[model samples]
Target: MDNIYIYMLIALAFLAVADLVVGVSNDAVNFLNSAIGSKAISFKTIMIVASLGVALGALSSSGMMEVARKGIFNPGEFMFDEIMIIFTAVMITDILLLDFFNTLGLPTSTTVSIVFELLGASVCIAILKISADDSQSLLHLGEYINNSKALEIILGILLSVVIAFSIGAIIQFFARLLLSFNFQNKPSWYGAIFSGIAVSSILYFILVKGVKNATFMPDTLKDLVSSSPFQVIGVSFLLFTVISYLIIKFTKNNIYTIIIIIGTFALAVAFAGNDLVNFIGVPIAAFNSYEAWSASGVLPSNYAMVALNQPVGTKPILLLIAGLIMVLTLWFSSKAKAVVKTSVDLSRQDNVKERFEPNFLSRSIVRLSMTASEKFNSLLTPGSKRFIDKQFAKPVQALKTKSEDMPAFDLVRAAVNLMVASILISLATSMKLPLSTTYVTFMVAMGTSLADRAWGSESAVYRVAGVLNVIGGWFFTALSAFVAAAIMAIVLYYGRVYALTGLLILAIVLLIKNYLSHKKQSREQKEADSLERSESSSTQGVIIESAKNISNVVKRGNKIYSSAINGLATQDLKALKKNKKNITKLSNEIDDLRDNIFYFIKNLEEPSLAASNFYINILSFLQDMAQSLDYISSVSYKHIHNNHKKLKFTQIKELQEIDAVMETLFGDIKSAFASNSFTEIGTILAEKKSIINLVTEKIQKQVERTRSEESSPKNTTLYFSMLLETKDLLNATMNLLEEYHSAHDEKVAPARLPGSADPSLEEE
Candidate 1:
């Protein structure tokens, strides 16, 4: 009996570890995405922080454990075996459910699953207790049903969603306002001080209050610490404050990216520490009870341990170890992210930066809001589009960029989450209600994601509605778990002959199904790879043939460069415009050709077509540079329109230099095309370095002189316009040049066209 008990305890320990790993891995997606999506911190940093959080959450989770132990059905009413059956059913079901969701990358609530599973198991146990020797039952089933913690859990979930949504919106609104002001006036010390105070207060309350029971400190240590809780808190607060201040001061000149990273990590740690037990608490509780009964040589009871007297034993230590395991899991997750990057369709992510064009609803709202403002302004004069643009549109544009639009709401939501979680957890502790942190926090994030319109217009409202429906579905989860556990218990009790054997068979079947599914997926993937390769090879051949045609066009164009340069330098607007038109036509042809190449590359079936596509992209970029040169030449002609012969000596010098550079680039392009050799392109590209530097310096001087002279409005506008055109032209040229140089360095060989020699075959 002693040995059996010892083995059960060991098994329970292992189960606890398994729960920790699964729970943390699933929950990780909740907070991890925000940090990664924002590019605010590295995966390694988040993992470390999350690990610490899990450790702390597990260690301090005694308060929640007590709630779980006593708030469900009366465990004393059932015999020892019944209790063991219910617990075992709940644990197995909960683990299977959560791990399944995690594998699908769906963010389900572990807390909801566990609570429901326990409810199901407990309900089954209750029904059996009522039916078996009712006269000796500790409590009636009616009384248990009416007074279970299910109601409280339901209410908590509902209230958390509402409160979290409201607070997240309000906080984000104000935070955006502050951010806008800061952008206009640089981040002031006052703003930093206020933000720090607010963040610190929220962090302390949530981490300290929410995690009170989950701490690693033993009773003795806790008693010692609590005797002077205020003093301890005060000293810790002071120490952190000093450190934070120094960090802020040191990073004042740099962006506060490091601080944000550190804060995010700390938050992740806290989340792990507080949430891990939600996943594994029941299994640990059941295992411990099973061990105690097996040791006492008595039939196991269905009765749950009393709330206050529940044994924590080494569970907190086990939880801390679980946290460490999560860090390693996070490392694996990062590697997986990198491996999938190329294949993953990032269209949704790209949509994040798409311009916010107003739909009918938004346009109506904007029109309505501006009505009053427009009427007031109209009293002075009739409103023009310029008025609307200046007062509202421009400011909004600037604010949108500074705030990063709705994504800025993520930080606000996180902050409010900590505050709300602390208060709710504290209330639950005081009132002895069983609330789930996982359900509350995740629902809150979901709500904020909706409110901020992060899901974009098409899906935002529907997703929000779906999330609410899911919350309702959580009740079903609890009901199902309770029912499943009860049924399993009944079968185990009355149909004992094949109970264990049936369960083993069921497990084996599930394992086999999973294995077959994986194999099928692998085979499909391989087939897809083979098809892709065949398609890519054909596409590569077409792109290489297209490149040869483009190269010939480029070589022909180079012959006309000297004549174009003379027209560009002579301030002959008519002649320059004609030359520009010819260049533009060539550029358009090249662009069309490049687009065809890209389209072909994309449709290629081969897996290695990505490399081929890269080479084509480089060629396309070079074409863009030729077009930009034409635009610059056009701008130069326009600038000297009125005073052709009186063109500024400085302007003339700049044009001559630009002309010389273009001539040299054209020669290089011609040489590369003729010899099918791109090796010297990189050095030729680097030759632009001095010219770019000179142009930038000249523009700066011109801008400064104009500002100092208090030039006329027309002069100022003209000066700035010309300067901007120069910059744009320079950038476009450099972009193409860089692409060419990079492609040359990569040494990607284009596939042989029809009637062409294979470059590889001809080598050496």
Candidate 2:
């Protein structure tokens, strides 16, 4: 009997672990995007910060446990087993549902999922309990419905969207205003420090304190650390202040960025700790009850079992175990993301030639949600759209633009957001409505996005309006959870329900799929590496020969330079035009080349300076080719207009021929990019450079000849026009080319690739 109880405890512990892991993995995405998009930190650093946040959040979660215990359903209405089953159902459903959304990169509310799942399970259990025991028949369904916490949760969920969106926009607005004032000069360290402290302090106070059951400081910790709220705040503020100061002085990092990252992590962790109980508390409670009963040697009586409160000492232990499990789950979740990326790439393969498609389930859901939103909109007041357009739509659109680049918070916007959030949350708490923080935050982001005109053009206003239209779909999360829980409860009551059996089946399926995917990826990567090595080896000799030829050409060009220059010039122009169409086609090619180069270089058994040098030379050659293209475009326009006064038709023909050579040079450059042939790129670029210099010299000579002749007004006007066009084209070309080059560089650079072997790639 003792051993059985102990085993049950262990099982409960493991379940807690599973709950924590799933909780963190699912919630991590909510804050992940903001940090990454803001360039606040590297993805790896963000994850690490999030992990620590989860740990601290978990440790301080006891206060929220009270809400988990009594906030949802009346415990007296159902027996111990029934309550346990409801909790288990909620946990399993919530985990799966949240993870599915995370995998899709869509941020949904965990609070909404829990509330709905709990409602569903509780409703089912109540119905079953009532039916089995006839004495409870007088307790009407209306009574149960009225007494239910569903209303509060629903209201909370809905109102949170308005609150968060408004706040985010307002805050971002003021932030931008303050930032703009220092346009010519960057903010000083003192400014950053002050701003960081102010924002962090405000966030900690409002979000941490105002959220009723937020777990940043558990009751136990408050008691242990200090007796008064003021004391606790003072201590925490001082500690954080010192830490921020040290980080700023030593690391020379942006304090605002750091504060945001930290704040995000803190929010994430608090979310996990508080919400974990919503997901798994009932299950743990039931398990504990079962263990208590088994220990007392009780057999079958009613389905109702003994109720057990979690031992105070055991709560911390349970939380720690859960936190660790959550970290592991987060790791698995990352692996899943990689798989999704690969799958996307595979679907886009040239051989497959299929239009990439989302799964049927996703498409169906989106369509249904859209239809529902349209119907709901039509039923509203005739002036509702106009009201939304004027009050929410216009301001939100304007605010969106101002919010870009992590704009400082505006007091007006913040006040508006706060008022909306406070009023909505207060109303929901009073009426017992369920609302979503994700919905609130996301909509506020959109509203601000709209208010600021972040989308750049008014055309996007409708699209954003359409996106805001979808916030209505979040209600479906609660609805679905409710339905799923009801169905699950029916199965538990009537069918042969084996909780462990269901869990084991799911675990097995996920494990097998994960293993197979990993194996396949490894095999594909090896094959790719092999192909790259073979290609590199074959191209090495050709590259060396071209390099030698270029060297000889350069050396012999001192005497009779025109002939050598013209020959090289002709070849370069012809290549450029042929490859212009193919430049955009090299995205995949560059990605593959980057992967191969990093793999080969990193795995070298001996010092391979030649190989390293070869890669560098190739990069240099590509750069030179880009410069040559710029020079050619500048010189070729004079011929296009026939504006050179002293030049003959023969010279014009020669210049046109040079344009042809420039076109050829661009064509080869495009092909090299498309094929991922870094080895050949250098040779092609060298030829391009030789051609550019030849064209430049010819243009310079024409300019001198024209200057020595009469400067006609028509000729001068033509020259100026040509010069303006040349400058415009050069600027446009450089901008486009620079973007392409930067993207390509990131792809090829070993350090830039996510999860690559190179340590530099590992750094942000």
Candidate 3:
């Protein structure tokens, strides 16, 4: 009996280690993005700075551990067994939730997850307590929980997004007005002052929010630092300002780089100081509970854990270990890169393509903002407008550098982002609000991007939509954490070790599966990229490069068409579903290619704009091929997924004939594209006619069967659909082959492809 509870505590210690790894993987983007996005310093240097911050932060974060113990609920209200179960539920839910978000490559609020999980698990156990104690009525439940603190946490979740975004925008609006896009050429003193203000703010934030919790700090120093805050600010500003000026005056050092490096360190330290509690606090509390239980000589269930309400301190050694895990994760986790990419993609200054598409809401918002801005411009005096325009004008060097580099924004904006977010998060920390570091950091970047014109008109809709999607994910995180924790708490309360064994195993399996899936996806993307031919410079390169793209499309298109037909014939839902996913991926790749036409044109040397026209036409034709496959695959998967009756034997037989013809078409087209020869295209074109005729015959037979022999409406409709789509697919396939043949005829043909859009490719 003693060993059973002891083992649970041991399992929790292991979970604390795992949580630190996953938690850091997800949260690394919070601090690393601004530094990396600005390219102010090398990535290795940024990690080193952030790693040092984490180590120092962990050592200073002794006081924050109480949040995990008594911040969400009153520990004195629950038995040792019930309290341990809640801790177990919260840790498990948090690791899974945070890991899952990292897998999606989206940043979510870990603070929100931990808080809600605690709230949820507490609520669940509280309900059980009420139900079990017949004499204690529902009205007495208030004594079991700290409702006010929980409300503050929930409010903090909502507040972080709005406040972070607004403050970032306001600060950046003024910062850009002062520095402009050409701030690099400004006088050293101007840069120094900006650096001073930023450094001072971060200094105050770090000291007030991060180190205020330090148990080892001398009392006199702590008092002076806390009480004389304005003096500290003045000294910091003077100190960093002189230091910044001296560096600029004496060396080739960029003040922005200094700010970015310092900012990264401060944010990382703040994260460890604050959010580390979310990871290790529970395990520490559980261990403390186990200690008390051991000394009491009471059975685990009978021992009440009143010690949790006391101010227990976290051991410095444990903090060092957690920080070490975080440092290692920052150094090696690939998922951290994925999450950082999302942050950079949303805030990039260029009009590059986005991963998330613009939806209707995004379009509407963009449209309204544009209209309002135009109206506002009209209201400005002529002189004011002219001056404002000059202030906003980007320098030529900055524009040229943007074309060459992948930095999402300039270092000034990066500095502003780091300064504002670190300030806000630290303020929240000192105020005892569990502000979401992820929310504050991510939205702050978005807000600064908006003010700095990174969300230019060309990509604003998509960028806005991406930000909204991430924000929506934050709200979903809270709901999911609550529900999952509640349900898990119930399972542990009743199911005990049996449930713990199963869930722990389930968690391991899920983490492994996500790891493998991410690995496979990364490998496939690299392989696809390696096969891509360089962009067309001359007519010959256009021909050669276009051939590679067309051949790849043909290979994928053939599989899609084959899977759709066979999946329907054999009712293989998995095959059809896999094809559906492949088709979507192919479609996105083509769409991205299509969007890159602008950059491709920009890169082309003078007198090669005609190549742009030819390139565009080739892309259009290939896109049609992909869409043709996508529609077929999607419809096939849906029909089977809905449990629609499989096509009759005769219908399958006719479809197989069409499938065979289409397979030949794919083969010949692939060969033509691969070899950049159309000698076989004429044969392929002739076969298209016979294939269409066969599809006509198949449809006519389906119609005849529909009138008399067909028993299932689903069967008849599906059969006729596949046959007609195959005919349209044949037309698109033949037309694309013909256009490439035209490309062969005239090495530099006109911009327009000869093929018409295949009407059948349109979604039904």
| Highest-TM-score candidate | 3
lDDT minimum window of 10 residues, candidate 3: 755-764
Report the lDDT tens digits of candidate 2 across residue range 1-764.
Answer: 24433443454455445555545655554444344434446657877876776676556555334334445666544554555566666665666666555444345667777777777877787777677777777455543333446676566565566666666556544544444323214435443444444444544433442333434436775364334545554666666667666776688765666555655564555555556565556556656566555565544233344243334223566667666766666556654343223222221101111123344544554567468758978898978666544432222332212211332222223222322333333334334445444564345545554344343332243333334334544666778888977876676555424643465367447645645665565565444212122123222332332232222212221111222223223434444332332222222333333334543454333455555545544433433333333343334333333434443444545545654554454455444433334334435534544554665665575577578863565444433343343333234333333433443344454333221233322232
Taken over the whole model, the C-alpha lDDT of each candidate is: 0.51, 0.47, 0.82
* Order of models, best TM-score first: 3, 1, 2
Candidate 1 segments exceeding 4 Å error: 1-17, 56-64, 134-139, 142-148, 181-185, 209-211, 214-249, 253-263, 295-311, 315-317, 333-434, 450-456, 465-473, 508-764
- Candidate 3 lDDT over 1-764, as tens digits, reads 77767878888988899999899988989899999998899888988899999888888886346767888888888888899899999999999999999889999987788888998999899999999898888887788878898788778878888899989988998888888888888888989999999999988888877777787768987787777878988999999899889989899688898888888988888889888888998888889888888899887778877888788777778888888898999998988889998999899877665878899999998999899989998999999878766767776544332242567788998999999987887677656676788899999999998877778878899899999999999989999999999999999988998999999999899989998998888787777632353355555567667777777887888888888888988889898988988888888888877767766776666788667777887777777777767778877998999999877777777777777777777777777667655455556776766777778877787778778767887766666667666666677777777776665557533333233222221212
RMSD of each: 21.6, 19.2, 5.7
TM-score of each: 0.56, 0.52, 0.88
Error of 1 at 493 (Å): 2.9
Which window of ten consecutive residues has the lowest lDDT sum in model 2? 345-354
lDDT tens digits, residue span 479-561, model 1 = 66666666666766675436644753564465456446645544643442111111223433433343444455545455344
Candidate with better TM-score, 1 vs 2: 1
Task: Tell me which of candidates 1 and 3 scores higher on TM-score.
Answer: 3
